[model samples]
Target: MAHFPMNHPARPIYRVLSGLIGLYILMFGVWGVVLTAGESLFARESNWALGLRTNLAFSIASVIFGAFLIIGASRRTNLGHYMNLTAGIVFLVTSILMMSLLQTEANFLNFSMSTVIVSMIFGLVLLGTGLYDKVGPPELAEAERRSRDKQISEANTP
Candidate 1:
């Protein structure tokens, strides 16, 4: 029997969430770049930080990240889940740091209260989606195997 990696019950949900997050990130980056006209590529104009500055560099990075998520979702690869999990953790940590250093301007990253809130939200969503289903459902897995086997048999018949 052949293996179907994306036969998990939660695969669809995970992929949808991943795609949505990717699109959001991509749009955010594109919007920022357009608004700033690339002048703030490496500038500190925006308070967002944690290698996610509101500049061109960050925008480009965000777009790439988004693209990865989208592509991973389309391909139904486990890598997408791992990447989302990592990104969630990073964003959450960054948000916490931003909140803690609200009084100081020289914090590792310069982020505002709004930025922290947004980051936290994004982090939670990513984490939730990534951790949705570590293991595939037993019934679904069996069904998937059967379906794949049937397809293979039919293909071989012709």
Candidate 2:
């Protein structure tokens, strides 16, 4: 089983990173909405917004997701942990799906190669952030840490 560090010392950094990503997404969405105001919801035509191809549908989705991420990052409880994990998976899956649909008529979000790359990067970061940002009681964290250390030592001995 995968062991996720709890009460990690670098939790603050991960939180900030997630927040920044959220801010960028929010800004990109707002700009996309402005640029694609009259365009079709799923327009296939190129409409660049904040360096990413977008449409009304994609812009709106970005706005909602960005807000969600911001809220998750602001929380001090495990809610943020779960949110980051979910967002990470969602991003990874979406990027793969969009990439596959990139050359097809089914590309509804008008995603570009750059967008896919960014999404993948964001997904990985979020996943890492989630893995280390778990919160718990002090004793539980200590116990988990000890277990992890023991596991590492055992592996090294083999």
Candidate 3:
């Protein structure tokens, strides 16, 4: 089974970084909403916010998603771990899909290349944070550490 660090020493740092990303997204969404208020839901007109194109539909979605991430990052339990993992995967998948439809009429989100790039970056960071943010009881963490040490020793012996 794959090992995800539990009770990592740097978990606080990771959480802070994730929260910062969430804040940025939230601000971007708010700005997008203000800028795109008079436009159609999925308007193709040029509306940029925080260096990314936007529309009412996309801005609203960003608001919700950003808030979700913020909540996840603020949690102290395993909920944050699972939430970050889910959000990471969603960002990655959605970015890829949007990138594919960039030139077509199907790009309802009005995702520019910059937006896809930022999403991919945020996805990777969130995924990494999730991998290291798992928390468990002391005994479980010790057992996991021992298991990791054993695996490392075995690999070194070979």
Best by TM-score: 3
Candidate 3 regions exceeding 4 Å error are: none
Q: What lDDT does the true structure give each of the candidates? A: 0.68, 0.93, 0.93
lDDT of 1 by residue, 65-150 (tens): 77776775666456766777787897799789768986675543335677678789888987876775244566876787788899
Q: What's the C-alpha lDDT at position 62 in model 1?
A: 69
Off by over 4 Å in 2: 154-158
lDDT of 2 by residue, 5-124 (tens): 889999999999999999899999999999999988999877998889999999999999999999999998999999999999999999999999999999889999999999999999
Q: How close is candidate 1 to the true structure, as a TM-score?
A: 0.64
Q: Per-candidate RMSD vs. true structure?
A: 9.9, 1.4, 1.2
Cα lDDT, model 3, residue 116: 97
Candidate with better TM-score, 1 vs 3:
3
Candidate 1 vs candidate 3: the lDDT winner is 3
Summing lDDT over every window of 10 consecutive residues in candidate 1, give the lowest-scoring window: 46-55
